[model samples]
Target: MTPRDGARISGHQYGAGGELCLEYRPDNWEPQFTGAMMIGSAYRLLSGESPSDGEVADVASAHRQTVAQEVRNTKLRLILNTTLLDILVEQPLLQAQPFTLDEHWFAKHWLAHPRRLGSPDAPPIWAAAPPLTEPRTREGFAIRLPDETNVPFEGSYAFLNTILTALNFAPALERMTASDAEMPLLLVHRGTARLYSLAQGTGSRAVYVYRTIVAPANEQRLSAEHGVLADQCVAIVGCGSVGSKIAATLTRAGVGTLVLVDGDLLLPGNLVRNELDWRAVGLNKPDALAARLDDINPSTKTIVRRLLLGGQESSASTDSALQQIGQCDLIIDATADAQIFNLCGSVACAERKPLIWAEVFAGGIGGMIARSRPDLDPPPYAARRQILRWCDDNGIPWTGGDGEQYSLQIDAEKPPLIADDADVSVIAAHAGRMAIDLLKGGATTFPNSAYAIGMAREWIFAAPFDTYPIDLVPEGQWGPDADENARDELGGLLREFFPKAEEAADEG
Candidate 1:
């Protein structure tokens, strides 16, 4: 059935849009979904036919969860912090308790601008059921029903009057509504919660309750089912377009700690491919990325090191930053910079850490992801050299040298194809997946340590999604080969730095 303009109807499972929210689609559209059938479903629903199981479950779920809500007319916000949620869950039904109405409570709980607080024309009334403070708190009442099956109130006055009558309290509905004091009535059915302000000046005005807490076991269950790396530590060295994205991906996957090392500022042009936006524009890349990571998962701790590796930075700070990167379980190089890669290679080899790096090819055509594990493959530098050799052998002109964002700046003959954010994200996400695989340990997803993934038709890629797995031969030992005499000299320096535990104990 077609809906008419500005027409409102009260019917089962029908929203303001006049479309039936719940219905069935037949396997064959032509024969099963005729006009008669469509009208039959609507008629049954409007005539008080029982809603399908899916519809009943949807209502029950919505009623149990407290999400962000707002008053349509007054534009007042309803806030429910974790503290209030805990009390509400512990005691489903509570008599009218003291609640405070103030603007300061809203300011402290949310991240809104002062000028944009509440409504624009006038100061909006804010209320907290269990007032965050005690000095200005007032008495409030609330109820927690088993479900929303038999409640019968249509407006604010009716709701308050009904609630007071059921609780056998002296009906003060008039006194509560006529005054400026905040008497918020919290209605909870099963787990869903709604808040109605008695002093809102509008009938049936319930401010939406924005529940500000996540269930603890919800994240754990999600991570456990997906083999999440919740206890692993990872270090990402390039908080650019690729680096920032990798950081966010890992954080969202429940990685416990991330060491973010980047020595650059988020520029205006970086928004094209960078995960960060204008809010982070002048901030240091690592600092901004740390904040972004926090927004994704607050439990994921971040150690930000704002120092450019292999640059003209102070030697002490550079070495300190490298030391932190070496301590991580896995290291990812998203900088696409040779100098930074070289420094990371040195740290990865010396610390016996796993390394994963990616480079998006010129234009958004494709990218490469390479990894070097301690005993599984050659060192980071050797693995990279082999990737270069594979490119040479395949007659694919290497297009990864120019230090640009996402892609290299090719000559006039082969004009560089500017890669969009999606192109960079593709490679970055693969790098993040490889990082997770390394952190998880044991069986790996990528049989080959290096892969050239094609996003578009270019270079060796004949069509999109053409993946070439380059086999990297692990040649020589894990660390650099040293002469016997030089090794003896290095042993003496190492002994000076770290004495035997027994020797130190004896000396003490």
Candidate 2:
């Protein structure tokens, strides 16, 4: 085989505007298959013609298959069932003239549910119309069908009405004056109808509205696998990088309601590792995260508490917050603050709810995720104590401790933490998975109740992605032990304050 002039071929990942990526065996490629030949075949195929003769039969077949797949992948923008247009289609016949569909028709006759956008460049915004008695007017024209021919590929208004004119149904077509050029024109062909938006100058283009139903967020297909998540309520403390990401993960997984607890502003510096963007800057973290979670899944409700837990709040207020957190199905302490963890631990143990927490190490080294269930693991403080001992036994000097296993926030005098977004995300995701497992209840995905995950070679981590799972055994029961001697002495002393039973009965 001989290479063509000006044909540049390199192993670079990217290519120029006209760069052609051709893969072939240098020693066994067909002599006739040259760069020019391939480009010519591509051009011919794009022009809706056979690429080449039998010299590239297999290539042509593969190209056709790819084109067919692309066509199949094309999805419609608007969605409405054929049944919705029956009344509008029949109204023109009763009036014996072309008619306009006002907003009332859209509101009463059409049903709509908001469609979730899967990507940024997804289809146009959906217009979901569920029947309401609201009187809203839309500039739209409707006409009776001409015949039962399949939907034509040509979208020109003139070309389509020309068929109506030939069928002697031109009266309605003539009624659509230039003033109504902007309105959508509906052409009914018996059971099916085609909608077209007539632009002022350009030819009309078909608005492909599918005749299918849209399910609400809770009823979406994801509900089948995540129905448990939809019914579970979770409270997340500390709406920072880890907390916000975990909240988003749970919301996307269809958690019914999130109790967001935080008292920090989303500063610009937080964007590098936090899930929130610049739009949330200066806003309270809990409120901002609530809005973000709604955007992710509208069905996931959020209750925002913009108070710094264990941080200068009134005892009454803190107790109220803890009471609310305890009511949730699960509590997540992403704060990694020892004091906050202790508060949350008290609530979890008293409420008999599951508690989960995680922390990303400084310098993006690694992180740890742990959970404590009332029935299985010890209290939150005891669990942290065990993890700290585990780290010490493994010779991993724990630098992040406020008399606890780890601390998410460091002192202002020390160097600033340096964990990147990816590092925080790794820990947050693991924490989220653990939360979901706790909510699902029964068999667990993670047998161990805690783990120390390494993202780089630091501390006890020998290599990147090193993981150590630590099993937690149940500790002693809660509350203080009773002393028989102290009880007997206190009983004799307290007997002085109260009357004897015989004297009390006589007085009564």
Candidate 3:
């Protein structure tokens, strides 16, 4: 329709004031919400560094900022949410606050840097947008509710118009008359709790609600059908390269609860491979990883054990750590430590909890994921044995004899060189999917208990490397049934860590 048809059209993607407005019928979303915050923050990625004393903040700044501009034409989108206030009908900004544009505050905070601006001071920075949280725009949401692709528009204008007036937003609506916008609008359907969206459209006053990420439609259907993910609990013993990504993968699959156990602190070197962010340096790996997971999927509950398995000297309570492992539905051994790996396998077997161990082969040559649960037809540790056997069968070099393998570590002392970050991520995805399937009771077909991915194996063999691919011999495999001598070698180091550990060993 033309502008003369009584509808004002604005910009194709953004608004007249650099705002990207969206509306969500909280009930219309896949993972529905009740309320959100529309407080504007700098549109940012990776939450970049803020402006220094006199320097200007980049378009994609991180966290909160305290500066307001009547005209932000240079760049930046103003965002808002229902987070601070729940009711759409009540807004403090609507109570009649005149524009207090202080030139000094604006100049100081505008392109703040040490050369000119001394330090931070108060600056009014508020704008309006729809309340959207934990947005994942790059990825589509897996689920959307109501299943109606076309929203009815027969009689929405009067109610929308009335609500805008009652909420004191009529002024903005009137201004919208002059420009076209691609805005997402959310509203309560028929005054009911259900949310409906007046999605993407080409009018100055239209509200379009879009999300960064949502649950996949198929997965949502499967969730309603079986919900195997919702009922299971997994324990990730490491938050390192393979482990952290595996944790994220399971979360994406709708796993309800995760127990993270790791005592190490995030190192700067870890940024290249692990999921830890720049903000997580020196923090406990499990705790940092847990926070990241919560930000991604609030529905997943994480319990962190920031104690080392060094046994008694570990910062975590020994009893509590063991109890956490004992209680989990499955144990994921991602630590790759002989001590941690053996310990997890032993405990999982003893407790009869399921176990999945995944590791990236030296370099990006390939990787392996081994699964074992109560469903195994063989004896204890069979799952572990099978995965190793599969690795050997596939020509995976687990022995150090194949020369120094590529590793994720930059340390010279650490051998088994490492794979590139991308290759490791590929393996993590393979392992995560297998883990989820095993949790689904293994009725579905899998490549075998021990799954391997050599997608880039040929590339590895092609590269002039220091190592050669060798079979994963029995000695290279660490499973529950391994000789007691191997267990004691590692267990001895941790025994002094916990009194109970020594006692249990003696008793056993």
Evaluate all candidate structures by whole-model CA lDDT and list the values in order: 0.66, 0.65, 0.52
Which candidate has the top score in lDDT?
1
Task: Give the per-residue lDDT digits (tens) of candidate 2, residues 1-508.
Answer: 2234544333211223333333333322578678776656445443433344533222233212243343343332233333344443554442232333323333224322222211225442223233223333334444555455545644666655564565564443453333344445555665455555455433344333323231222235553656788888999999998999999999888899999998778888779988889889999999889878876777787999988775555657777888999999999999877667766776787677889998888777889999988767877767887888888788757544222222334456656567778988999999999998788777899989999999887788878889999978777443221222333433443343234643676789
lDDT of candidate 1 over 10-35, digit per residue (tens):
34333465555436532325665777
Worst 10 residues of 1 by lDDT: 110-119
- Please provide, for model 3 over 1-508, each residue's C-alpha lDDT reduced to its tens digit, 9 standing for 90 to 100: 1133443222221333433222321123454433332212122211233335544343421223233432344221222133211332232222322121111123222211001101124332332221123332210001111333233433254444444455555533553343332222333222111121233333323432222111122233345423777777899987888889999988877788999988778888678888778989989899899888886667788999877764334444755686788688888888666556666766775577777777766656666666665534232244455545554665644542232332223356555436768877887887787787777764756635554556443533443232333222233223343434545644564554466866887999
lDDT, candidate 2, equals: 0.65
Model 3 score (lDDT): 0.52
TM-score of each: 0.65, 0.63, 0.52
Candidates 2 and 3, the one with greater TM-score? 2
User: Model 3 off-target regions past 4 Å?
Assistant: 1-226, 311-316, 375-412, 415-417, 457-508
